[model samples]
Target: MKSALSAIVLLSLAAPAAAQTPSDWRTPDPENILVVETNKGRIIVEMEPNVAPAHVERYRTLARKGFYDGLEFFRVIEGFMDQTGDPQNNGTGGSDLPDLEAEFPFRRGASVPFVEAAKLPADNAVPQATEVGFVGVVPVRSAPSMQMMISVDGKAPAWGLFCQGVMGAARSNNPNSANSQFFFMRGPYASLDGQYTAWGRVISGQDVVVAIKTGEPVAPPRDVMKSVKVLADIPAAQRPKIQVMDTRGPAFKALIDKARGADGRVDPCAIEIPAKIG
Candidate 1:
């Protein structure tokens, strides 16, 4: 009987160890992945077209024309974000493409795959989403339960959250003035919530982004993107197959469980899952 009890303990201990098996990883969708090669290093961004369709379309068109090749990182502010994509090599320049309207407060319904958490996070409350989960390896929050009632059509609203490495369109005084100019967040500032349009976030190489020069928006960037391309648009031989930890997998759930919160509650931004490129 004692030996049987030992066997039970061993099995219990092995369960979690085996949870991190082959099923935990997921290959990213090449269609939405963007690779930006910079003098410092590479930064991978996962585009969320559903969040901002027009912006994604504009970006794809610009990238196809090599509009970002040899572009400078004009505006870089430390402890905030690194802004670029301006053609003038300064804060004021963008593709001839017309400005995209504000896509904030993204409404959602059954169309989107909202991989929701068990409950609302005790930490940050955006007042729109009740729980957060991963959508295509990008951290996204889901609409509150009340909105989920319209789950069949997703007519309700659900906006994406801004964690570290999140990317958004930079605009002028007018919220609809967002053009090709964009920025990468080095830190989290909830004040920007629902103010700017966040279409994607970095899936890898946060260090390279951090290595960029630090200063005010007018400060010149030490390193600039050598080239930027959509993974699908790149030559088949040159394209990279990248994968990230499936946030819906048991491993991710374990990570969520083990993740420590800043105020004794799990801070979603605290968890930074990596993307593997092969």
Candidate 2:
């Protein structure tokens, strides 16, 4: 009896750590994953509707209709991102769906609006008129649309930080022009913020993204999106389970706090330790 009890205790101690590994990882909802096949390679992006529901829904809608298949990367800048999702395969194509309205307000130093009802209303509330800066208002009747641009340089706008492997929609010069073309950030770049509508990020297979070859120099260069498919189209149990670190959770705050000491001094070596430990 004592030996059996000891075995149970040992199992209890080992269970959680075993579950934390990949074997116990939960697969993302099929509806949430996008399989983008590029000429260079395939990129699987996990959509964060929690972050940008309108934009994510639009992308899913387009993907279901087979709108992104056969599209070319169209634009590739080394150390930057590989851009695709153009139905025209020329960096200028969209779905049959009409353009969507811009969701986040274009402002400096502001966050991407939260999705909760209380948060949404508060975000939509008019900022003090005096606080308005370079406002570009579109007619209220327009559909909510977004574009994709991968960061290649420093951080650009305040909407979202351009990290490695972000997925976004593409658009023309018009704020409402994003229809089908999208891009992935290969690296970090800040200059693209206000100019692009960021919708999602890559949750896995980032190595595939980094391996894509660049296109030739031309008026409108071309990389390739070999194909694009929704995860639902694939059989269940074959998909990989990816768990994102909860940015809003205490774990994240603790990480950030440790990055910049209480005095707000950043020690680069401190940041490296976590990656090494992981």
Candidate 3:
């Protein structure tokens, strides 16, 4: 079966220019782009400040300081996530920076652009929230009424989904204990939906993430992030220009229409709108 993207991208391939134009795509900002190179390959992450600004800032600070370079994935749990960024190379370590207050377990109002595209009032199949959609390319789950109960800056409550490649902070039992340690989701974990703060997601090179060396938690001789740099930190000539399929664009609309036309509901995860990097 053709993925929703495969079907639309095939049509886009026939009309390359229309699909390649600026309006149809969004180039991630250098400051917001994270470039991670492991022994396996490069993985690109697009930071989302809208959802968890503090966590994003912490990540940016750590990345700029080269805090993550040479750090091993100290904890890799199969079917859960790959945890890293601990300077001590174990789950016990953290950066000099202070721990961030929990930004979630609260409402993020529905003012986000993608929430509108979610067709919220119609029906959302997501069990975790009344509405579900993408914030850019990052999947999010939220409740419209919860957003209404309490909203910040006209935005409603929405939590980034713990789907494949979702980047989130690894906290102690305390919700606010999140510091430098973070994890990349290897698969879906709906149980984590509203509890953690997800600052970004892998836009490409996810295969490398799936290939991350896995063993017992706290195991040694595991895979490591050989070098981690912000796309802006890298030489301009060497940086990759990443463009995500415009959720607001007609191409995405057609894709959704096709998917919804055939199936009463669309699996948001199955839509597969990947970023195009050049």
Candidate 4:
């Protein structure tokens, strides 16, 4: 099923060349940024703590401990995803931390910086009709604010979408088993939406994520992440100055408009949020 949509997914994420003034870019919080130096190249990820707080905290704790360095991409599939973060280098190891509960179906309050792309009808899976859009660089499906009026809490439920470049926690059949292993999506896969915890999205290096050598077992000499560090942890002189297109700004609004299809609905995964690293 996924293979059939591979071509379309790739094409949809193709960002048009846009020259933006310096004001269009915004610097991400260093604490929420990750610099993944892989054998292929540097990949920058902007994590959304608001979406999956526990998952984001776990990544930060493990990264600060240097637990992610030297881990290899053990399971990579073309047009799918790249799974890594196993100390055993074969997907059977994790940090000693206890497992975490699933973080999806989070609450999306009115204050969240959500840029709506399209509205979706309610379904069995999501009882409330939802609006799909980008909350910063992360694609999300959220119940409309109207749902908040009668709710016990004042916020509506929302979850991250498994869009291209999204980051998801790898878990066993048990939904809460995610510990240290995670994957970076190579293409959009909606099936994983409520199944795994999505904590962030790659703001840069979608090319390098897809360029990872593809294999279920990824034979010897598999690509490795040489170092994974929180941006704030890197030395001031050594850190790569980074900026992502402001999702709330007109430039990103234009990008969102450009991604809309004939039906005027945007494929959350089809967007390639632009970034710059200096």
Candidate 5:
């Protein structure tokens, strides 16, 4: 009888420990993964075309053509962002390509995968607020699920939250002036959410991003992106196999609950999706 009780206890402990075995993780499409080899270190960004299709295409096109190689991070503001993708190693220059239109407040259909982490209370400014969650690896703020019933289409509005490691395109005062220049956020800045175009988020080497030289215009010895390419463009043998924790899986749901604690709420930016590169 005592032996049976011990076996049951051991099995319970082993179950959660193995919850994230191979099946709970998803491999990002190689074509959608941006590999930026900077002086600081290599950074991996997983592009979400479903949120900003045009922006992702622009990044992939330029990266494949070697347009971003050797571009210096000229405007690196500590605790803010590390800016690069300029040809001249200055804040002013960009690729010869035409500017891109702003991509914000992207609409999402029912088919889009979303795992809600926490719900926000309605305030005076937001009469009918909703929950915050992750759509793949990107943190997002989405409309209430019930909104689908009243909408013309079955889609609802959603936008990516500006969490740490989130990537946003640099633009001039004009809303549509985004070009080659972009920045990797070192910390969360909610003001940029509805304004700038956020195309992706860093999956690895965020430590390298924050370690970058800090200045409004980094002095002569600025860090440079030695090379940039889509992961699929790299030779098969040389490319790293990257996998991220699938938020839809039970393991991630358990993590969300653990993060929420007794309050039953969590800061969206505080949740991190684990990633592994092999």
Candidate 6:
């Protein structure tokens, strides 16, 4: 009986380990990553090739061609985000490339779906849960354009969370106005969803984003991108190598489980592992 009980304990301990799934984690294509250098500091972002292949490719082409070398962060909203990517530095500049069809419905997880609302939701009416077996929305084939932004807040139903250092595409008053000008999420703000197109997320240098000075009473806040360069432009031998956590892996699931309780509220740190980069 003692030996049987010991075997059961051993099996229990091994259950989670056995269930752990190894993922084919690959580095972002050098062409698909951007290194945005701001006066505050630098941010490293990985474009979602799976979600917006055309935009990602176009951005890579533009960056490699020196299109974003000296742009400024023209719009800085305090406690929100810093917007930039205007080649003209006048809040309205873009590449010679024609406007591309919007790509919507990129899957991050079970939380959100990317797409435009053909019809607005009814007042006080919550949409039904999305049906299972839904793959994600895809973009129409058309011309390619380059623009992006970053998020710094919680997740949205139709948009990426405004997490620190996230990158997204800049747009005009119209939803399709995003051309080349973009923004970076400086802080948490959920209201911008459906108002902007989220195209990428920063993988590093979030501390630089936190340190940016907030916009003040007198002038438009400034957290300018000193330079935006594609990793391909840098010599292979000199580029920084980073490994991102696989969001779909068992480790990530364990992390999410540990961060929140049965009720969804995050537990105090005393009972949880420090949620810092491992």
* Index of the highest-TM-score prediction: 4
Query: What lDDT would each prediction earn against the true structure?
Result: 0.68, 0.47, 0.70, 0.81, 0.78, 0.48
**Model 1, position 174: C-alpha lDDT score:** 79
Cα RMSD, model 6:
14.8
Which segments of model 3 are wrong by more than 4 Å? 1-21, 106-111, 116-129, 145-155, 261-264
* lDDT per residue as tens, model 2, 241-266: 44443333343334435556455543
Q: Which candidate do you rate higher for lDDT, 3 or 4? A: 4
Q: What are the clashing pairs of model 3?
A: 107-157, 108-156, 108-157, 109-155, 109-156, 109-157, 110-156
Candidate 4 local distance difference test against the native: 0.81
lDDT of 4 at 132: 93
Better of 4 and 5 by lDDT: 4
Candidate 3 weakest lDDT stretch, 10 residues: 1-10
For model 2, the superposed segments whose C-alpha errors exceed 4 Å read: 1-27, 39-41, 106-158, 216-223, 261-278
- Error at 84, model 5, angstroms: 0.8
For model 5, the stretches where C-alpha displacement exceeds 4 angstroms are: 1-19, 124-127
- Count the clashes in each prediction: 7, 24, 7, 0, 0, 16
Cα lDDT for residue 173, candidate 3:
75
- What TM-score number comes out for model 3? 0.83
Cα lDDT for residue 26, model 5?
84
What C-alpha RMSD separates each model from the true structure? 11.4, 15.6, 6.6, 4.0, 10.9, 14.8
lDDT of 5 by residue, 172-225 (tens): 777787888888888888777667777888888888888999876788888889
Task: Return the top candidate by lDDT.
Answer: 4
Give the clashing residue pairs of candidate 4, or none: none
